[model samples]
Target: MAKRAFDQASQNQPTDEARDAYLEASRAGQSQPPETEAPAAPEVEGQETSEALQKQPTEAEDDQQKLQLEPEKDQTEQQQKLQEETDKEHPEAEGETAAPEEPETEPVDFSILKNGTVNKGGNVVNEDGKAVGRVTEGILKHLIGKKVDEKGNIWSTDGKIVGKAEPVSESERDELLKEPAPFESFPDAVVDKDGFVVSNGEQVGKVIQGDLAILRGKSVDPDGDILDKAGNVVGKAVRWEPEPEPEPEPEVPVDKSILAGKRVNKAGNVVDGSGVIFGRVVEGDVKRMVGRMCDKNGNILSESGDILGKAELVPEGEREGLKEGPFAELEGCTVAKDGTVVTPAGDIVGRVIKGDAKILFGRAVDEDGDILDKNGNVLGKAERWEPEAVERKKNPMSGRKVNREGNVVDEDGNIIGKLTSGDLQKCSGKEIDDDGDVVDYKGNVVGHCSLIEDIPKVEEESPEDKEKREQAEQDKKLAIQMSVCIEQCLDKIRPICKMITEKIDKAERTPEDERDEEALVREVKPLIEEGGRILSEAKGIIKGLDPDGRIAANAKHKSAAREATPEEHHLADVLKDLTGDVTQCIDNAKRKLEDMPHAKKELNPLWGLLNEPLFQILAAVGLLLAGVLNLVGRLLAGLGLGGLVDGLLGTLGISRVLEGLGLGSFTKSLKGGKKKGGGLLGGVLGG
Candidate 1:
């Protein structure tokens, strides 16, 4: 029963025989006691019997079972061992044990995927957020779902340590991921993190809109498609080529044949074959023409071309021969080249002998031996010439000579007037009739010319006579200069004298009852003072006349030695007279004023009439003194003692006073009369 039940249990288990043997052995061991007897079998069903068999076992039966199970047990042990080896070899097949629960692992931090995708289009970036290389499809497949270690190293799903995760800013990561993983390839160029295309560390261009690249100012697509700024395709990029250098131009030659047969004139003009001036030769050397006119061969030619002499050499005035034409007649006659004078009708009048045509007919002849008519036109050239004699007539009343040319001469051979028609015309514009009387003029006849012998011709003077003549002329000029000086001095004195006289006369004319003594003194005082100034000026003039004292001393010495010239003696006498006269006049005028009834006494207003006679005498004396000085000055100047004249007239301010007195013309004459050569007063007066 136990066997059947065991068989039944093994059949219900797996079909493994070794496992069934081991299970039967295990049942036998458990059913049998250590010393139990065998038991009977139950006549029940297979299931109830198997239950009973499992519930109780007999002692004898237990022993029998041990004996039987021994070999089976060995076999079961071997099979059981084999089966445990099989279960070890195939734990998943049936009753495999659950793998020992692995320790609960922490969730992987895939935060690196938040920064960028791990795909073929991604970049393998470095710590700086710069792509070191592209994320290839193989690299992406190896790296997907991978976690980064604390060191940023990424391990692949296949356990490979592939890439690293760099913790970059959000913006930087976004910027890096905007472009495709594998950037466009350009020769010697790459895109930097800043989207600039760099070559050999220099930024050559920029990447715009993530993929549009700009190079050399032109837009370029990732595929190297070149485009305009408006996004229109223009062309494709090509390899760079350098431009070729330009070639030089060839030089041209100059033509100088144009200058052939040409010559430059002195006027710098270039002349051609026909002697026509073309242009000027500003530079370079060339043959020059000689004269104004030239032949075709460039030879100098005369004006008429027949003459060899250059026309330029002829004098302009004589080129036309004689200005006067060949006349038909002259002086009532014409002359042939043979010196025969003929009438206008070709009749032979006379023959010129020895060129003295005047002898033939008393015709006029020029010094050139040319016969002339009365109007001085040349009739013909003569071989020789002589002047015609002039006829003279005598004036019986005046005994003066008159000539056909109207000159009238006195007996002394001095031309006094001209006789025109019947009247004698004087230089003064007065006429004298042939009756020896002044005609139609108001002048008395001071004298009449007497008949005298003809004057002899003047001979050449001797040296001594010349000296005397020159000395006389010098003395006359000196006399004139001195006279002018004295005249100017008197001119200055005259006005003061007149003013004094007039003032004194006015005082005298005043009625005694109406006379103001103070007024009379006031008016007369200035006049008296003025008279004193004139006296002082007169003294100064006398002193200036002999400023060096040489003239006075020389005159005195000459007079004592009796060696003085007549002029010198005269000068001394006139100077002495003038000095004495001026002194006496001044003294008398002073005495007259002093002798007044109240002259030296203090003014008594009551004695106005007494001063009247005194002023009148003073005025009369002043007027008389002026007249006396005038006479003396005129006499001294007339004597020709002008060398003693002083520049005191100008020095004492008398020239200015003369100008004011309307004697300006006289003063100007005196100044102008100063000789160019030094005179007595020249150095002193700035002549």
Candidate 2:
């Protein structure tokens, strides 16, 4: 097998020298026939000596001799020695010789391996001069400190064959350089940098260090070839065999009979025949029955086994109502077996009596005992049943009494059978009077009642007193009519005064040359006349109300006015003030209108000339100069040099020059002079 591997590896050799060396090694390995058992010495009568057996060549000595001599001579010498030993040991069988049994050689694939040479230092190096690994196995111990050729053939100092170097590769060299993974069995095994299994720099092998030692400088290829750094085949990777999976335990079938006659309670617990909770069904189709008191037959029942509904009878969303039995049918309300109506919060709201329901609170109830909505409309009703009597009380609003049956009663102690509208009536079918008395057809008081207060009697007045009263009423009527007229006058005066004020303000805001004095007068004249007319009319009405002027005279006297009634004095004073304001507003409007014509005459003709385009351009230039000088003046003022600006303006005499041109105000602003006038042109024209 070693020869076969060498032959295959030689085919891939890069150089002829390497190939020849591989072939020579293969031939050398092939020259030695496998060691076999020496032929048993024939029986010899006189050769019973132990010395001859001891002197006979052992297998190791024979192998060494074969390597030193030619192959044919070695075989011939070995046969002659065996014959001599057989004759000495057993003379009777001297002519008979037993053939040797060939030894078995373990097969190794050398194609995946590379040659490594052993140097004088006892370390192995591959063809690239890189360290492969040291051989420390006892079988190849003689090769230590001996020279090995490129073909891995090891020779002694005398040129005798010993053993071959193990194979190594570049790929294994890289793997050895990695941080070693922890291995429990090879705690002491470590790889050196040169890819040798070492213990503190001393070479080791599998025989001394166990199987883990072989992995120290080797790596398992993907194909499971264990290789050393120099491409030598070291060992094979042991395939990991997983522990067999435990045989699945056979499934124990559920009897399912245990669930017979079971039911799911409102809490989702599965109850058995006696309603004792067995276990809970957490999921699956059975989970839909959670919070539903349903039996296995799908009958939704109460805790007492009353069938309120069936699971299939109601939609899935409405099934929760089954838990409460019949009571859940009524939304927001519930009814007791005794006909006591209650809200879902268990508050008693009404009662069902004799198939008629009555709600004591603000809510209304129908004949079927269901509470009605805000508009007294019933949504649905509960089952009707006769209930026990509930006490009756009088209606609070009417203060009328009620019978034991909750019907209204009149003053005659007659049952009115629940007043549906208005108050109760008499037994005669006549409406009761507001004074709580019942009268006959002729208007005679037939019944004297105390259900409400009695009506008071009114006395008749004397003729003389009536006359004074009528006269006083006539005076009050006249006063109110005069007051109304006064209000109308003031209402008219208000708009006139507002018109005059607005026109005057508009004229004041207008530029003198632009003001239309005639238009202002025309607009204000009518407003002032209207205001004067209103004031005159209002004063006449006031005089008519107080024909002697006594009310006005009394109002002027503060002490006398205090002694008089406040209403009388206050009305007189309001009318007096109204007349005064109307007159003042008229006089002010006339004065303002009268002054407009004169003010219009005083406007400078140059102000009108300023409106011309040439004059406007000159004004713009003057305005620009004013703005620049104004900025300079402000800067000088901020720097505490304001006096300098004043002096500069005085020296320039710009103000005097502008004054001659009717632009004195413009230059004054640049000189930081007092701010006055409507604007640039308004100040120049002195309007």
TM-scores for all predictions: 0.21, 0.27
The C-alpha stretches of model 2 lying farther than 4 A from their native spots are: 1-487, 502-523, 539-687
Clashes of 2: 14
Q: What is the lDDT of residue 204 in candidate 2?
A: 42
Q: What would the per-residue lDDT of candidate 1 be over residues 299-369, giving only the tens digit for each residue?
A: 34344554222112123343333344222233455445545655556555455655444433545434344
Candidate 2, 1-687: lDDT as tens digits: 333333222211223444344333332232334232222222222222111011123454432221111222343344344435435666654333233332444443333224455543334666676556433211223444565554445556887655444343344444433344423233344444444443444444222222554565554444444567898766544333336699999987534444445567665555655656544544444445544455554454556776544432223344333244343344455445545666666666545443433333334344445556677776445543334568765432243433334354657766543423333343244333444444456665444334222223457899978975674454445445654765676677667767766887788778877888877756665665555555555545544555664443432332311222333333344444443444344344445545466533433221121122212222322232212222322333444433332332233344554565445544656344324422322232121
Tell me which residue pairs clash in candidate 1. 36-59, 37-58, 37-59, 37-60, 38-58, 38-59, 38-60, 38-61, 39-58, 355-384
Candidate 1, which segments miss by more than 4 Å at Cα? 1-360, 363-485, 557-596, 599-687
Residue 464 in candidate 1 has what lDDT? 78
Q: Residue 344, candidate 2: how far off, in angstroms? A: 15
